[model samples]
Target: MKRFLYFLSLRTGTELIILTLLLNKISGFYGLLAILTGLHLSSLQLSMYVYSLFALALAGYLTPHLRRQSPIHVLGLAWFYVIDTVVNAVYTAAFAINWFLVIGQHHPTAVRFGHTILEPENVTSISIILMLWGLRIYFILVIMSYARSVLRQHVYSTSSSTGLYRRENPSDPDSGTSIENPFATNREDGKGWEGRLGRAMIALVRSYWLGVDEDDGWARGMGGKFRRSGEAPVTFGPMERERRRRSGTGPLPPPTSNPAGIPWATQGTK
Candidate 1:
């Protein structure tokens, strides 16, 4: 159920943000504000407002523990909330615009023009508000889309490519593994969780500059020179070497013996 909610949040959030953007494009700022006010007002019609308030309180209460779990998950969840806001904004704009137009017939003077140069009337104000709401929604949707795209690319890149090759004998170097089945897992290939994670981090960094190259096939570059077999080795410069020397003992040295049955270093001879 929790996982379902997580996925649902992502999908709904994306859709909402997109819809919000569309609303803003159709409406403007005052329109957005008016729509928000209307939505807030309408909240009195049901227990939605109470539930929303409660949910927020609960989220705040669990925030510390949630943060400790996985910061990435927290960020993903935030993306969903932003999406939801966009969705709400779009809905509010649509509702406010329709209500204003329908109610305007009964009260024509309520739509009176302002004293400003353009003299935008009540109807114009309502339209502008709707447009603004749409625009805000669009902004949030775009940001969320970009984030999700980046995250997906990261996930793909870090996952193991062992699933890309066919089984092969350990001793037979000449017997090449079949690459026909790109997504087939070969346990002998040494591609595991850790290797995949390293690939993912590297892919994330690379994706920023190169963009996603999804068509290159899943195993294309996964087993190449770029994929690390083990944890990356640390390279120390002169400054680091000096710092290490001053800090304490460096890596432990090998054992040695002196000719006179005493350790060479302990003997203190020339």
Candidate 2:
């Protein structure tokens, strides 16, 4: 029950969050069509629908690159979230105004659904719209939180060979300790989705909301004492330099005098 609650909570996994965003985009698309079919929507609503379509397309293009820690992709998606929020707010207001006016002036005796005559009661439709809007609001906040975390890490974090976040200047001899970025959104290094997806979500929440900044100074002192694990060894050249010397692989040096500075070639000829 506890685990189930966690899953359903606002703090969902990254993939789940993206999935929700995609669904929201799809719903917005269809909702626009429904509104257009039922009534004459203003130019503003039409513009909003076009904007939503563009945002959806941008998100689909950038998602894969964003997962690979591309800063540009992350920034693009962040801007989409912000612009989409404002546009959505405007659209909602417009919708509410139209809905209220319809209820007020066009109070019909009955709404004909094909052959059936049903009493005009928008209560059910309004309630559903409100519920969806409320959920969408929550999702927007979560996405912004996640984006802010990514931006922070992009500015402050360094990359490791494995493409994970590392403390800045990991190769600096005086850098003390190599600290991993706490805000790293990538799944924890391992095999299963549990390690990558579930752990990444938990870590992202902790780093962003719980204030888990990378350990520095005294906490890192002990870690600093251990030799840097991922440092690549410095090699002046090739190992074959010494091996060639031992095996006398190159051209022989010019012949020298045998003894007492006498030339060996001259002595042999004499």
Highest lDDT: which candidate? 2
TM-score of each: 0.34, 0.45
Candidate 2 colliding pairs: none
> How much lDDT does candidate 2 score?
0.52
Per-residue lDDT of 69 in model 1 = 30
* Local error of candidate 2 at residue 232 (angstroms): 7.2
Error of 1 at 15 (Å): 25
Overall local distance difference test of candidate 1: 0.44
Looking at model 1, residue 187 earns an lDDT score of 26
How far out, in Å, is residue 33 in model 1? 25
lDDT of each residue in 201-236, candidate 1, tens digit only: 334434332333444353343434333457332324
How close to the true structure is residue 26 of candidate 1, measured as C-alpha lDDT? 36
Q: What is the lDDT of residue 145 in candidate 2?
A: 59
